[model samples]
Target: MRRGMLSIVLGLALAATACGGSGGAQQGGALQGQRITVAAVWTGAEQDNFKKVLQAFEEKTGAKAEFLATGDNVSTFIGTKIQGGQAPDVVMVPQVGVLQQFARNGWLVPLSADVAKEVDANYAKVWKDLGTVDGKFYGLYFKVANKSTIWYNTQAFQNAGVQPPKTWDEFVKVSQQLADAGTAPMSIGAADGWVLTDWFENVYLSQAGPQKYDQLAKHEIKWTDPSVTKALQTLAELWSKPNFMPGGPQTALQVEFPDSVSQVFSDEPKAAMVYEGDFVAGNIATTGKKVGQDANFFPFPAAPGGSQAPLVSAGDAAVVLKAGKNQQAAQEFVKFLATPDAAKVWATAGGFLSPNKKLDASAYPDDVTRQIAKQLIDAGDAVRFDMSDQAPAAFGGTKGAGEWKILQDFLGNLSDVQGAVQTTAQRLEQEATKAYGS
Candidate 1:
């Protein structure tokens, strides 16, 4: 199907139901008067938006859902729940690798037949494949983040007379121009290691393409591969510039992700741009700056000697755990979430992007968000999942994992590119051996 046509069809569907679409209305008969529990890592505003969706489900079907915010370490918390002989009916697994682990451990149950059909019809093959484990469907992808975005302070860009660059060389030149205008060009946020990993992944994917990205994620290629080193060198082009990064690498090592976004939008802004996912929009909103006006974003530019710009993304998948008490009600909720109307609910609430192709782009609350949703759909087969999130937790997801600390150290000293690559390769081998017994 043509990409533009697909987008139009989705937009029409969302527009038609913009006023009175209740996601659970279709399944109210089967789910009435039942209650189920849901567990996920979302909290604060994100949790609130999800709760709105659950409320609609409850209102339509007469079913009740209790939400549990598992914070950042959802796997650890879920494991503890399982060990205690009490688990939530549905869990929002944040990583495909972790979901696969749970499925392999026989802790997850297959989706109900109707929910499976809804997934088959609404999602692209790549999304469905991510939720599948060993030929069985066990999860539903509900929310997505496009990490290949470079958010900028609109006023800063206008004041500096610089436009968003389309290529890496242009990006560096613009950064220099912005610096000359007395604005630090970027916020690094190296304190949180995942942000650093995201930096490396985008450079790698843009430079090495999706095939290499997949191989690296699966550990078929060592971190010391020539492609890996090349990508690191490319990152250093910006990282090594003293005036480009606010407070240099050391300050970045102390800043968390939210603070990083704030740095770009502060009254006296610390930087002109922040490289992160769409979630930054929510953080920007909290600063009382309107998105697309005070702040807006452009796609991360194509790297030198690379393919077209790639979209690096990650999502939360809804999985049914075998230990849950309300299995039937849980299945009903999962099916409801799979519908385009359910996706539209959260999409309209903001700070969410659904992988469900049936959802219309018009359902998004604003142009900035709609643009992001369109970019995700336009990406099609080129969308690559976040590399670190798809790797073993001990190697990538953990706080002090080799991928995190090694990259953090590299950000601290851009001159040690070779040493960083070698150390990362060594640690990855060790961790893979330990985790997989290979």
Candidate 2:
């Protein structure tokens, strides 16, 4: 089956998440004396921030929401729990592939009438459409990240006398100008395959347009298709220039994601920019540069040939399990997750973005984050989910494998030669065939 779009499962589904209670009356008494268990991979500050959202749910509904850490293997945790008859009542799944699997297996419960209604009104059509799978709604996006923003060092831009560009050709020119001014233009974290995938996704989305983006994501079109080849060649415009990067491609292969962000935002920055999602701010937090002042960003430029550059984004979605003991309570918890009240809990504390359109701009801690969050809501139908995340897990989600590994190799082999780029695309198609088949 084709996957659901980035999804609205948008309104509150489980008001407080799911109560671990043994029984429940209706949505009214769903939370009374119940403890709902929600599983996700968030830890450290991300985890602490969400607890506040859960607490808000608790305040409104008399239910206890429990956090279940699934580490990076949420699928494994859910599978194990299902076998043992101890599966979590609610899951905030980051992988769309896993959600599709659960839905296909009938393990998921559709959103109740009230929950669906709230979602319909609170979210845009794009979110509403993605929420429904084969005509039944299942997942509600809780947190969102904009992957189309390119964060640059404010000092780097000022010293180089370059302004943010609006098209790919202009962006390439600006990057060269930054290099000419004696500062490396980019901090390419080729060490993290997902970062490379994001770079590819932004370029591809802008250059190839949505139809081809969706086709490639679904493997409806091969990776070696002309559209993909064109995207790869465009990326080579920057990736192939060794001097444009802090340590060139090979040295970049040694730098991980956090270090990449740190390198650009440091006291004495090594490069002018780093590209990733809004979550890049999390890594920037550990640096000396302030986000809005010392660090600022612009939306990635559009393609040269008049193609649009839309939002490429990702986030966790809340879904309830049919096997959960407190089914109505689980529904209420998810419903609560869709509200501004719940979103504000995390938004104010930092490092969180929501698809809840009703959420206010002031809820965010800073203008940098508020602007980022606004893009997600404002893009409406112009947004696309992270392409790799929409594909099967073996192909899209694993570490050192599939899209991650193939893109990593492609990053290492960056060149202006058309033939080399085509070869990498072929390799990607070959691996994608196997993973999607499996």
Candidate 3:
């Protein structure tokens, strides 16, 4: 989270000359190009793929695009840079929390009206609308990775004589059956804290529909709602089941959830199922398992006889800065991003789901990916952005990690579920007040 001196220098230089007017100059000196520096939170292979796409952009536009790609503590670093006035022309934050902060602070500007129209015309309006604050669109949502999914081992389910659970009772029955057969039923870890947040979100989806989740995001619904409390209590009950989660509370207190997910992918008497986002595809591939064939998914089911709901999902967005030196150039860059070509580039990258409706899923590398992509697009308006991300900054706050820890503690203890929900809800409300004038 510490600010680097290099960032400080860049911040000073940009502020000195560019603050008074749009700093839209083509690259100075030998750079001799429309130089735009973009920041993203992607790293390693994901980072490499981004570079390739930016290179494609550079080649097509004859503009010089540079990337400030980092993997560690991106939110803090981006916050520091914005505060220091050294913000990039465009920043691709992984979380909506950071984007909302930038919008609130006036660091980001609404997408050009023309850009907004194009986005709405070409894709769903909600994607563009979700990034907005105070009636201005601050970001262009390029891709989304939906998280509310249940991953299962195909062969193990067959061996256990089970079908993908179609209801909540069925889900629990399948898990207990796996446990009775001497196989670890579910792969879960909460050592890093945020892993527990997944359970909160999933149960929240089950108890309260997507619209309620959106209300929770807006702080319109009180945190002490009975539904919210029930969601937390239900997760505690599941976590308390015998041999339910691998290594139980002890291992969860020590391991990251992704590692736990890898266990389900390869380790045997194999784990039967895991609930996670699309990111688990990579972790599974890293374990030498293919997703569609070796592993597959089903949506978390509705309450018995309750209305079926769209899967809970989340996405990342790219945005131009209102205070940036190069507004028009950045706007054009965003246009390029929304095009079919760029959508193809991102789909091929393996970690993203492009929002462009025109990009054919058949073009994806495998059937599993194609099926999932089709499902996401066909999900229509049912897809809700991540609640934590959509929430007012004060409630959603940095406490997501801490809240996850609190959830784990509440689950392990079992007796304190109601108290834990009440306390966390109060704290979140207080933080929201701090973020926005109540």
Q: Say which prediction, candidate 2 or candidate 3, comes out ahead on lDDT.
A: 2
Model 3 spans with C-alpha error above 4 angstroms: 1-32, 79-86, 304-306, 391-402, 415-438
Per-residue CA lDDT of candidate 2, range 1-438, in tens? 011111222134443443333112233343556678888888999889888877777767667888888878777778888778887889988866677778888889998776776677677766666666778889888887889899999988999999887777878889899988999999978777888888888888887887778778888888888888888887776688757887688898888888989889988889998888888887787886689888888888886453677689887888898777667668878877766777788989988888888888898999998888887888887788888888877787677888788777777776545766888788889988997772
In candidate 3, how many Å is residue 125 off? 2.6
Task: List TM-scores for all candidates, in order.
Answer: 0.89, 0.91, 0.84
For each candidate in the order shown, give its overall lDDT on alpha carbons.
0.82, 0.78, 0.67
**Mind giving the per-residue lDDT tens digits that candidate 1 earns over 1-438?**
000001112234333432232344333444556778899988877899999888878876667899998877777888889889778989999888879988998889999777877877887777877788899999898998889999999999999999988888889999999999999999977889999889989988999998999888888876667888788778876687868788788888999888999999989898999999988898898899999899999998888888799789899999998988777667778888988977888888888999888898999999999888888888887888898888877777778666788778777876665665566556656766665445
- By lDDT, the candidates rank as 1, 2, 3
- Report per-prediction Cα RMSD to one decimal: 7.2, 5.7, 6.8
TM-score of 2: 0.91
lDDT of 3 by residue, 300-394 (tens): 67653336644666666788876556666676567667666667876776777776777777657777777677767776666777776655433
Each candidate's clash count: 1, 25, 2
Model 1 regions lying over 4 Å from their true place: 1-28, 416-438
